[model samples]
Target: MPQSIHFISIGGSAMHNLALALHQQGYTVTGSDETIYEPSRTRLEKQNLLPAQTGWFPEKIHTGLDAVIAGMHARKDNPELIKALELGLPIYSYPEFIYQLSRQKQRVVIAGSHGKTTIVAMILHVLKHYNREFDFWVGDPIEEFDTTVRLSSTAPLIIIEGDEYASSPIDSRPKFLAFQPHIALISGIAWDHINLYPTWDEYVDQFESLAEAMPKAGILIFDESDDMLDVIGQKERDDITKIPYLAHPSEIVKGETFLITKQGKRVSTKLFGQHNMKNIAGAITVCDRIGITEDMFYEAIPTFTGVSKRLEKIAESTDRTVFRDFAHSPAKVEATTEAVKQQYPDKKLLAVVELQSIDNTNKSFLDKYKETTDAADQVAIFIHPGSADSGEQITTSDIQKAFQKPSLHVFTDSAALQNYLLQERDASHIFLFMSSETFGGLDLSNLAPKLI
Candidate 1:
């Protein structure tokens, strides 16, 4: 008989992907979740893998199950979890199972507190351009890829967006720790997830531990431009190969960014920003390690549209443009704001950020966002007053005081914020909506047409 696997809280982004992967691998997969969201719900339904209903049933757990995979959303008190533990079935976190699957393959883990999704997307773009078959698991949906997760036994390469977040409820270690990578890239480090890591040094230590997890023959690729990474990369790891990459040589002309390659080929890209240029360089280094040459790297990169929500253009008019980004952290907010400003310096820039993610909503994390919005011609910071979870709360005054920028505006009500934005936005201003979560139920897409 084929192996049987069950997933707890399988409706999550990564959990659903893992369930699909296991099913594709010929396992008799079953899963349960308390709630199901779109995209995951639709994708899983298409695969005939959606649960019969929303909630979990303890009866679904049986002794015949070969293994169980638990998601972070699943609590220890979950009936299915209790059943699985009672039966003594082998259980794995999503990352743990991925590590097991890619153990023999050349695993390239793209890790950092920021830019992980973009860096992973960049590497995948180049590999896909060359038509080289490889399995990958990224966070966001890519335009060229069918799904965010791909797994195959025959594929020789696997690239994963190595997140520093917890793997599962039972696992306190960061998810990246599960993948003992043959090659790894640390883009940059910044304090995030205050609820988890608690301190700046504790967060920094995760990357250091990730570097130490690499095999002796493995190569460590990191960003030399980041001062913290530069220091961490130089830490005495004599057995592994340390390859540090700086930002790719580039210049902005007429508000357009072009990359100058070592071979003198000037490659212009639709993607903008110094941070993106740095991401491209990091991707190039990883691609080189996987046998792709510099010429091919430059040739393939021009076709990259970047991952969805990483500065995704929602609508465009003769006089204005609207962009939506998944930038929620301090560094990401700064980088994305600066990118938009630099891209359209002649146009007035209006940036609106939602404090929905854990890092963005935290009081301690707010200080790091001090001057991130300084470049914006006008800025609005919106936080849903009743949206605080896990006892984390931030008032409008707290946010205003934290940023200390004269142009900053704070709003607790999403509707009021939307109204304010509609009034403030004009034909000459570029509107950028940034958040890792939904805008407190505001439909920005519907609002975009009215703005245009």
Candidate 2:
């Protein structure tokens, strides 16, 4: 009989993907959640993995179950969690379970405050280019891969995009901590997850601990250009081989980005920007450790169009293009805005960002947004209070003062924001939609009414 695995709060992005992967692996998977969103819901329903109902059911947690995986969305006192505790089944956070699943395989964990998805996507693209067998879990959608997460018994390696956020409601440690990567890369270190890390030092300490936890003989890679990552890279770690990489040399010819090889050969790529160049370098470093040579990397990286929402081209024409990026943090926002502006120098760029996280909208972290969007000719900020239960309310004046951009626009209503974008759409303007959420339900992709 197939081993049974029950999931609590399986409707989550990662949770649902993990459940689907496990189900595909022939496990008897069952799950329950209070709510489930689109794509996840549709995918689950397609697999018959969705529970008969949305709410929790203690009866779902049975003694015959082989394991119970839970997401942070579920409280410790959840009925199913309490039932699982009563039954004494093997319960685990998805990250821990992933580590358990990959124990026999060499693990490559890509971690950072930003660039995690881009770096992972690059690595996956390169590996797949050479037909290397490996499993992976990444945040953003990749056109080459059917799902964001994959696992198989035959693969000898697994690469994961490791976020610094708490693993699960029951596990407060960062998700990357559980991977214990055989090879690890810290793309960059910037303050994030302020609610959990609270202070800059405390947040940095997590990456420090990640570097420290590497097993003797493990490989550590980092971006040398980032001051914080450079500091982390310099830490005394004689036990591991530490490699630092700078941005790969590149030039834009006819508005197309290309990677310059050591021999002065130009390797064309669909990706752009200095940050992506740095991300590509980090990915090459990792692939090198895994036995993929530089030549192999150059050939494969070009086909990697880009991640779904990271600088994704939602709409384009001869004169203008609209892009969407999952960039909400200060560093990401700055890097993304700069990349687009640099790519199309002559176009008028309108960069719009949405603040959906409670911590991100707080006054404590507000200063980070200062000048982050300066690269764009016009900047807009959207605040969706519905998403952030942040009882800490700030006015449009507070946002305007925080950004310090004289021409910056702020919107509290979704309709106003959509109308603003629609009105601003024109041939001379290049639109950049940046947010972690959907701009409180604004479909950036659907807005692609051919800005020609």
lDDT tens readout by residue for model 2, 362-446: 7778888899989899888999754343565677877898898987999988889878777877624788888888787876556
Give the clashing residue pairs of candidate 2, or none. none
Best by lDDT: 2
lDDT tens digits, residue span 184-295, model 1: 9999997767778888889998998998888889899999989988998978786989999998888789877899977676898878988898888898899899999988
Clashes of each: 0, 0
In model 2, how large is the Cα lDDT of residue 28? 91
Off by over 4 Å in 1: 387-393
Worst 10 residues of 1 by lDDT: 384-393
- The local lDDT score (0 to 100) that residue 203 gets in candidate 2 is 92
Least accurate 10 contiguous residues by lDDT in model 2 = 384-393
